[model samples]
Target: MEEKMNSGLVTSSRKKLTIVDTDVHHGYRAQSDLYPYLTKFNAERFAEWGFGGLSTHLYTSSGGLHGQRVDFDAGEAGDGLGTIGDAHYCSTRLLDANGIDLAVLTGGIAGAASALPDVDYGSALCRAFNDHSMEHWIAKDPRFRLNLDINSQDPLGAAAEIDRLGSHPAVCGVMFSCGAPKPFGQRFYHPIYEACARHGLAVTMHFGSEGEGVNPPPSAAGFPSYYIESRQLRPPAYAVHLASFIFEGVFEKFPTLKVAMVESGFAWVAPLIWKMDLDWKGLRRHTPWVKRLPSEYLVDHFRFGTQPLDEPADPEAIKHIINWIGGSRTLMFASDFPHWDADDPMMTLSDQPEDLRRRIFAENAIETYKLSLPAISQAA
Candidate 1:
């Protein structure tokens, strides 16, 4: 039997399956594109001080097309070339072409602006980007869902934004863009998490913002010089955030809150969970509020994206790692679309069992994001 997905892609199967991509990126064509969304004050400030409201210099590093795929066309035609492109490119190359049921739009500006020293300006930029994303990306396709880009610097403002757009039928989660001044589990961020739980929105902490503006160094040893070196530091950053959330008791406060670590590899998760369980056995006295083991919260409330999928020398080792991490329930397929390192859905985790593959590609996301089949299918 043939079952048609909400995205209008039909699959030869009795049961309808959804391919929920958790980490698709949609960026603006230019800084000027946000001008209309910005307030009069922020617009003038942007003209004078640029992005950070202090310096025009952005985090510079050597990488081909800023790590985007070389073959990705920016919809260039004649004189109308040199644009930054938008979600349509993703729809063309990834979503539509790959039979993706739903893809989450994780915008760049919201995360980038989170590092700015000026909290008010950073919050404004996040709001502007959310508006821009709603108008340009989410409104264009039902297959796409929004991860509300928020500024962690202003928790109150972040919560307010969540309240404003949290109920939007197209919105599924909230994104912090990683690079926050403090660990997400701290008291400072509880308000944001509280707002997310209220809206039944998952929280996605994507990789970015480290060592830029007011954000701390990427790793404990301080900043690394090369892009490769910086990429190597992402896992540890995720580990720290996970530890903070577990130890600080964020889960106990908002039991329904779900957290997804996007663009952060999953190989380190098994070890981190094992080690935390070992330490918690003895250290449980200090953080008594954490009634269960640390790993329990992780397996219950946490999820990991499968992009930049850990490629060890032994290909079979990937299977072993996935088994150790609790199978498809803990992993979601993320393509990091339009980026140079995007994974091809047909190729990712091909060796996994059919059941596991279905969960990673679709089932896990449906449960985590609390999405309905009819809603997802109708969007397509």
Candidate 2:
């Protein structure tokens, strides 16, 4: 059954299946949009310094929405990996079109902001972005939710920012760039996690600004020579953060906190957990705060987004591997909408069983994020 909206549009009944897209990138058309929310000093700095952020963009395609579908119009300019668009365009092309119930807006620049060497500017940029998001994006649609972007380099400021906006009705979680100079588990970042746990907000690690600015190489071995290599190393980039979260006992400290890994394939998850579980048996003494098998903590506290999901030679191979890792319980549906590689909800897991599809598309996210589903209003 479909539900009709005030706009005279229809969507799949929420009662039937609630499609909560975990990863939807949104942002300002340019830094100028942030000026209204930015402090005078920051606004002036932005005017002069321009976007002082840097990343290993040298290895990735800088065109076509970062290789996103450039063909689809976001109804605003700078669809080329930008923040110029709004909810109406997205609704027409993605949400209502796909019958999606809710789509979390994971603005692309949040992670990149953290990559900046200038901590104050990074934090200010994030604050402005957060304010801008509330006014422009989240305010525009109930279907939209925001993951407040943060600069990990300024733990005190980041924690303060969390306390400032953690309780907002539309804000869902906090996001960190995977290009982080240190493991997420390090004490340097604890203040941010502590605030997140206090507010019961999940922490999201996403790809951005790796191998540039203050951030170290994307991989432990170091930066890759080419874009393809950079793409392949994406999963490992998350692996380091995951390992830090587990080994550093971030989960043990913040039992209520959750972390969602996005834009990273799930296939690498199984191997990493296997080795951690095995090594933890002997290395448990080194980190005594960890009270359980590493795998148990990860399974309990972590969630994964299925975007850019790996499609192996055998179509069924992903299903089997997903089951081995965590299956429907751990996976959540994400379209990465407006991006060239955005996965359509219907086309993404078509081969999987309907039961798993339903769980991944909605139930799992609701549980992990403790989502507050907005009341459904039917059109007369």
Per residue, candidate 1 scores C-alpha lDDT tens digits across 1-380 of 24432243545441244578888777677667778989999988876766654221233442445455666664521111112356666665566666777888765566567788788898888888889889988887778888888888889999999999999988899887667788888999888988998899999888776777888777888867776777778888888888999999998899998898888889999999899999999889999999998878988999999988999999989998998888668999998766667787767887778888888988888888887544545333
- Could you tell me every candidate's TM-score relative to the true structure? 0.90, 0.91
- Candidate 1's C-alpha lDDT? 0.78
Error (Å) of candidate 1 at residue 141 is 0.6
Candidate 2 per-residue C-alpha lDDT over 1-380 given as tens digits, one digit per residue, 9 for 90 to 100: 44443233444444366689998878667657778878898899987875574533656573465555776664554423644366677766667666677888886566667777788888888898888888878878887888998888899999999999999878789988788778888989999988998888889878878877877767768867877777888887888889998888887778888899887868889998899999999888999999998888878888899987888999878978888777778899888766667787767887787799888988888887778777741210
In order, the Cα lDDT scores of the candidates are: 0.78, 0.78
Mark the regions of model 2 whose C-alpha exceeds 4 Å error after superposition. Answer: 1-15, 53-56, 60-66, 74-84, 377-380
Instruction: Compare the candidates by TM-score and give the number of the best one.
Output: 2
Number of clashes recorded per candidate? 5, 7
lDDT for position 106 in model 2:
84
